[model samples]
Target: MLNRHIKSHSQYKKHMCTFCGKGFNDTFDLKRHTRTHTGVRPYKCEICSKAFTQRCSLEAHLRKIHGAALHFAYKQRRDKLYICEECGYATHSQEVLHLHLQDNHPSSTFLRKASKKMEMTLQKKQGEDQTENSTADEGSR
Candidate 1:
């Protein structure tokens, strides 16, 4: 990752935007940048049914507009999903999505740097389990 960051400082941009001639060191950035020109809003809010170009935008809309709380316990990792922008292929496993990108869309700019993992959000199932356990303990006491 450090090597990739160092390479980003160089004059070379491996991924170039077809729309505006913008250059990016990582293909992931280029893929995200292309969404601006393509107007492809892949991330959709489940509550309001509104769409967004980025996942963070959707999350912010959920928090701000829909009053959704995104609190997570310490050291808890959230459920992750990797969706293909080109084909709408969604997967819970990052490795599966990576393999799909490599095999299906080799020419596309969705391939990110090796060893870089996307930040995950918390899952509701674990919280529910904790609640259930606490209730059981209180009943036993």
Candidate 2:
């Protein structure tokens, strides 16, 4: 089993392909590169009609362009999902969910950030009120 986080770049780490004198980051990437030579298209985009040899690339394109709308139907159908309620898109990972929010739901992202700011403000106000109450008790005694 390969360690997902472990970096093993000695063989194909830097994408050095012996078959066609090309390099890729991963095996799928190498396969995609090989497809360039063989002209094998496995995945096709429904929105833009772009062809890719790997399914991941097609998914990336779909998520990047039609995240909220196009990817909307993807979550329920997918085995694994990262749901983003802000934009209602299901992604493969939380990182992709964040990316979707940034790329597709910018307004919701801003609102979330602004709501956090408001929460901090309220916390600070509560702390100030507690200190004021303590000082008032000290003066009364």
Candidate 3:
């Protein structure tokens, strides 16, 4: 990951954007950068229905985009801003925050709990939708 991040900003830029001629050290960074000009956000969050060009950005959205009030409203608090209990580092992102936690506080179960909550929320919603569909089918018969 460090190599990829470093490669992205290194002086030996290899990949060049076709639209704006901007250069990048890595192809993945170049592809993500191209999305800016294209306005393409293929990655979508199931929880809040937000889209992002990169998976990392979408994960960030899942960690930080929604406020606490809105987060609770949508039951999407998993996407809310995360503040490190160990250090002062804060971000509205997931993978980065997870990395921070793993690096700083190895034994913390916060990430696991957050992930489980999000998964259970999604499962509950799916079950509700299935029940509604089944009821509608029975009514139609």
Best by lDDT: 1
Candidate 2 collision pairs:
9-13, 15-23, 15-24
Can you give the TM-score per candidate against the true fold? 0.54, 0.34, 0.41
lDDT of 3 at 19: 81
In model 3, where do residues sit more than 4 Å from their true spots? Answer: 65-141
Backbone clashes in model 3:
3
77-110, model 1: which lDDT tens digit per residue? Answer: 7677677766767678877887888898887656
Cα TM-score of candidate 3 = 0.41
Each model's C-alpha lDDT?
A: 0.76, 0.62, 0.68
The full ranking of all candidates by TM-score, starting with the best, is 1, 3, 2
Error of 1 at 31 (Å): 1.3
Native-structure RMSD, model 2: 17.1
